[model samples]
Target: MKGGKIGESGGLTFWLASPGDYDDVMAISDGIYEGNDYLPHRYHSWMTEPYRVVILAKRDGKLVGLASGLIVDGGSTVFLEGMRVCSREQGRGFAGVIQRFTDQYIRQLYPNVRMKRLVRGEDPRPEKLAKFSLLAKRAILSLQIEAKAFHAFLSTLRAKLEHETGTGSLEQESRLVVLEEEQLRHILLDPGVSSQIELPGHMIIQDWQPLKLVESNFEVLRRRNLTWLADSLEQPTFLSLHTPPYPIPYKGGSFRFSIDLFGTKADLACRALLAHMEMVRGAPQLFQDPQTGGTCC
Candidate 1:
């Protein structure tokens, strides 16, 4: 059913997402997360953030597909972080349809964003033991997870996903699932772990730091710094990046991303940040200012 008549199906309509659409999108998303042990819980935040384009395709008014993300790298990178057409609609060629519309819209709205990147992958931990983060397990398991294993897991999974999809989508999926850089620090704050080895059991993570596990090789902080700079300098910029040294909520020994405004155009920087700030300030309750970075992260 490649390139099947999609628009002709008239029942299909693509539009921007509304608050009312969360329930519908979540229904499918939650099912996908639960059905597969490999999937993580990042979308809970992704959906709530602004600058994220939520494009939904409805068939006979029933939601059938969802594409969500934002312009990044100073609108030079339109990251297609998540794109899913219902499994039922897969072969109907609707995925390509949504992709086309999304790509075009980004081009119109944010002319600078470059290529789209998507991610997909599996959990390296055995299904049963996947949740435990070595840092937390030290007190209980008495053995920190081999950070080397973390590196190997990331390298292998990334390579494998790229091989499988023949594109970067798999890598995108992997990033989308786990905690972002700031969220990693936030996760470390959870009071879930306290004192010594007692049992050998499957660990249930309150928040996983999978992204942090990749930062060592990815140079995420440096990349984010460069991205922040680009966004501040570019025209009609759309940018998103995580803040670092993000400590516990109350602890607050500040770690933040700083933009050297030295030669940057202040007007564009301020406007872009302000627009993003306003956009996110309107998000659902599940999202808060801290996690969303209030404007810049």
Candidate 2:
């Protein structure tokens, strides 16, 4: 697999993943997440049922960069997960080439997929990772922050998409993700995603409250859902957000958190609550300007 010349690095290649390429793929994966923690093991499990792709960049005879992704639902959706370039090959536009090629490749493979989802971890500067002597565990938390930021950014982009399509409700147009206590327990205990987290089920939800977004000035509507939960000390709280298609005048977003009588620890729940609130606060910033679209639509 190859892409046309762009920016600095020229003549990039795109290729499909094979059983034999697992070692090389693993090598690239190690380089990408060498010290990062918090990333679920499922993030690196490529042999799963979903389709996978590996796009490699080479200059002369040595590898310079690589990209890995998966096709969900017969290529209707593409998830660009991991991407990295060699240490010596920095500063060039090779990263962009990999991204563009992956986007084009998915479109060519699955014409029905209305959109593509790509996520890059928090460490934008690969060079810093090599120079910093930070503990591996701390580095992982940094990576988690990056993952959360990426996820929140994606959520914001979904909101923008609703506005562009003239949808009445951004929440309705975008997928609503439910993270219930039962579901959280499953996620933390499930072998698939939980095994990666040492503190899986231990991270309790302390509180949950509802969220709402009233139309204000922006033509774009806000995206909120009843999918999040806040765990309380004695009970688990269910948090939900109800958003209008467009901003409601004079009324800010309204949300409710249904606290369960029987839940988890207070500190754990509060941490989760704060994280969700922060996400809600940042989500709308992407739509602050009506004239701009930031990879969401």
- Segments in model 2 whose C-alpha atoms lie over 4 Å from true places: 1-9, 26-34, 37-44, 72-76, 120-297
Q: Rate the local accuracy (lDDT) of all candidates.
A: 0.41, 0.40
Lowest lDDT 10-residue stretch of candidate 2: 210-219
Residue-level lDDT of model 1, residues 104-143, one tens digit each, is 7667777766555443343345652453333223111111
Candidate 2 accuracy as lDDT: 0.40
Q: TM-scores of the models, in the given order?
A: 0.38, 0.39
lDDT of 2 at 177: 44
What is the overall TM-score of model 1 with all chains considered together?
0.38
lDDT of 2 by residue, 166-243 (tens): 665543432324465445444433433312332323222121111011121001111122334333212223222222
Model 1 residue runs over 4 Å out of place are 1-11, 33-50, 122-297
